[model samples]
Target: MTSVPHVPVVVVGGGQAGLSTSYWLKSRGIEHLVFERRTAAHVWETTRWDTFCLVTPNWQCRLPGHPYDGPDPDGFMKKDEIVAYVKGFVAKVAPPIREGVSVERAFRRGDGVFEVKTSEGDVTCDEIVVATGGYSDPIIPRMAERLPEMIVQMHSEQYRRPEALPEGAVLVVGSGQSGAQIAEDLHLAGRKVHLAVGPAPRCARFYRGRDVVTWLADMGYYEMTVDSHPLREGVRDNTNHYVTGRDGGRDIDLRRFAREGMELYGVLDDFRDGELRFRPNLAESLDFADRTYNGINAAIDKHIAQAGVEAPPPSVYEPVWRPDAERTALPLDGSGISAIVWCIGFTPNFRWLDAPVFNGAGRPAHRRGITECRGVSFIGLPWLNTWGSGRFGAVGDDAEHVVSTIAARLEGAAPAIQAAE
Candidate 1:
């Protein structure tokens, strides 16, 4: 039997969130062991793509005392730029990260510690933070199982570029950010792409001349406390933050794709023969449902009109939405579609974490990322706080809090995080 290594804290991922946590722990004079599935540079390098860019603007990519004080503050950071930024973060604050240690299982040892069993060996820690993000697993709906064996299919995670796709039409599912962008990309690549949009609120790729993130910050949207406001609750409950990227920018938003030969349908109903079917009357249903969203925009327009706030002409950033009643279907070979790409968003992965702290949703039931369960905590969750908890600008706050909690617990006091815990 191999002996399990022991440590003060064990962070189970080496991504942006995990690195941030480790960085803060090191700064606070905390001893930690970071078990990463891959090497430091290779992890970020694998996630990189030609068109990959952060939706969060450069200025917002701040982690603790370190912020992205690059040349371009307003613009988004490309994949290489982000990788370089993270590399700089690691170098400046050298955290003890162990690469190539893929965790196989994690369960509480009952002595206020966690026993993390990895492929290489095992380790024990006073605390564990599962920083692996939601996108680790790609989920294909059950309907996909019935599709014809000849049909080509791939999820957004597998798609690197338009050139990788087989030459033919495409069907993209899940109208969220990823789905919308992939559908738009395939269509732009001269492949007939049909998008199956679920019931979701549409957002402009940008508002005015500035990025939508700027407007969201200015309007107190990001600042809204998750506990106090219903809209904030809805934003947190329904979906993750939606900051549009270059792939779905104002010039080539989802609505433009609909106008440019990319058919937009409702939810995917079923697949039979060589045909893919969907709900009905997708267009008319969307029009009716959009009336509600139009009301909100009209209110904004009315305010602008009343305030005499003259703005530049509108860009191609029109709204995109789907009505609940609309159920349209489409045939696969009928549209000449050769592949199906699922761009649906991600969910957190907690499979290795076998602790009893998980809530009904399978997320660690920590109070603001601080574990109520002994010897366990969560970090890097989306929108963990109002000021910032999940974003690059916000991750440092959560990391600091988790570190403090660990310190306080060691001191035999209640885990009192000075900030964001």
Candidate 2:
């Protein structure tokens, strides 16, 4: 049997979360190894489409020791710019990162140490940090299988550009940021676009000559926790804003798409014989989105009033609805919709970790990234501590907290191990 190399700590991802954790560990002079399945910032380099740009402004790119200080702080970064930024960070920090090495499985040993089996070899570590982020696996509806084989389907992660898809109308099933952006991309590419709307929140890109994110930060909205927000449950569980970074940051809502000749439908309910059924609540969903959008601006206005900050007049966006156009059922062949883009969302998969670290709902059981099981921690989970916990600008905060906890635990006596009789 080959001997397994042991280390004090092992991080099992190479994205922003993992990199941030590694930066903190290195700062403390802690010995650790980062096993990345691919190269650093693999998601940004590969998963995102060619025209993709970050929804968050550049000023919010707050990796530790690498805050954005460029001339265009308010400008949104494109995909290549983000990849280069992370690459620059890696070059500067030079952490102990092993690219192209994937951790296959991780489990606790009888001696209270973790055995992390990787493609290259096995590693025994005193502590393990999982930084795979919130978006791990692309979530597609089960009914997707029922669609006719003639219809080509792809997830938003796999979608690159309109030319990459078949020559036909596209049905984008989800009104989140990705779906809205992709739909707009397709429309610009001269493809007929049909968008199925959902209960995604929307906000204007800029209000009163300031980016929406700037306003959000000024109002301390990003600092709000899941437990403190009025829509606590939804903030923790729902998809992000249905806005876009395209056109230099602008609102991309169902109304805009509908007015632009893009077909809008309700939630994709089910699939029948050569046809797809949609919910009849298109009007209701649009109303809800508009209310949520206005509510955000209203909060910002109230904050400005209380703080007595000088700001321009707030912009009002009226709702746009055309109930007669929304169809409940459309045959796949008749609509010329040869492709379906499933932008439903992503779900994290931790099956590789053979530990009881998950809750009843199969989510990682952690409070601010600290698990009940000693020496195990999680980072990059949405709403882990606050609204920005999972974002690039705020992931370092969570990483710092987790690293400090790990450092404190490592200073004490060895972890307790239950011996079998």
Candidate 3:
């Protein structure tokens, strides 16, 4: 008779979150294995554009024991730098990882142990930490199919460089972080750019005398959890503030692009009859973004006053440009747009993990990584614990919490193990 392999814990990813969990589990003397179907840098190397950089400063690269050690802690890490950082964490952790081993399915078995089916072989484990970060599948709109066959269309993930695009104006849909940054990339490259703006907010690169992130960190913003948030779980669906770390880290002011030669429109409504349709919400969306920007600044201003901090004289942004007329439509033939980049974002897919832990919207239903099932948990999800949960900033905290929870459960079940023996 053949004996089946078993591990006390199984981590589904080998990224920073997964590696962080491994670090904590190792410290607790827990036996486990991490399954990663690809290298840690695969996503960074493949999906990100050439000029992509972390909008947050390098200081936020807090991967458990391996924090950012670069010379410029305040500066952002570019594509290569970010990849290097993740790889450095993997090297330092030296996690017991099975690379190239795909986790086909994971479910809590009838016996309480988890059966994690993988490309390698099935294994039973007491606990499974799903660290596969939220952004899984690119969300290109269904309207993309109606576009002219001659017009090149690609999701933001596939975009690399402006030179790689067809020669003509490029229409970038969705003005979240990716859209804004990509539009800036093309604009800087002297490409005729058309942007379809969304309600994604924006923040100044530097507010007062320091980075806005630093101010927020000082004000305990990073520590703010889901429970404490005003919007609570709804904040999870909020689009990221559009900013850029391309040059020396700057706010991606879409209005500024409008002031230049770039054309701006409202949210993309549809694509039909050889024309692209837009909702006449350009002015509203821009106002929404500015309000968020000013609102954040206002909070910082209040904090400065109460804390008795001397900083630069506070200032607010006035709209640099407004649409002369809301453009409702643009004919594709003369629009000069030959390529379309969809920067809407992605939805996390947990379909492979056939577990009842998911909510109605297909999101993992858990409080800060702990699921109702004793051994099934999630990590590396936005708002998993705090605003920084999905990023390197607070993944360690989530990882520690998950490992501790599992450890406590094991201790509680120890009597059963002895009884069975």
| Worst window of 10 by summed lDDT in candidate 1 | 315-324
* lDDT ranking, best first: 3, 2, 1
Task: Name the candidate that leads on lDDT.
Answer: 3
Best by TM-score: 3
TM-score between model 1 and native: 0.86
> Which whole-number lDDT from 0 to 100 does residue 159 have in model 1?
73
Clashes of each: 8, 0, 0
lDDT of 2: 0.85
lDDT-superior candidate, 1 or 3: 3
- Give the Cα lDDT of each candidate: 0.68, 0.85, 0.89
Residue pairs whose backbone atoms clash in candidate 3: none
Residue 97, model 2, lDDT: 91
Q: Tell me the deviation in Å of residue 67 in model 3.
A: 0.9
Q: How many angstroms is residue 214 displaced in model 1 relative to the true structure, after the best TM-score fit?
A: 1.5
Residue lDDT tens for model 3, 173-206: 9999999999999999999999999988999989
- Candidate 1's residue-wise lDDT over 237-287, tens digit each? 554322346643443345556667777787777787656677775665345
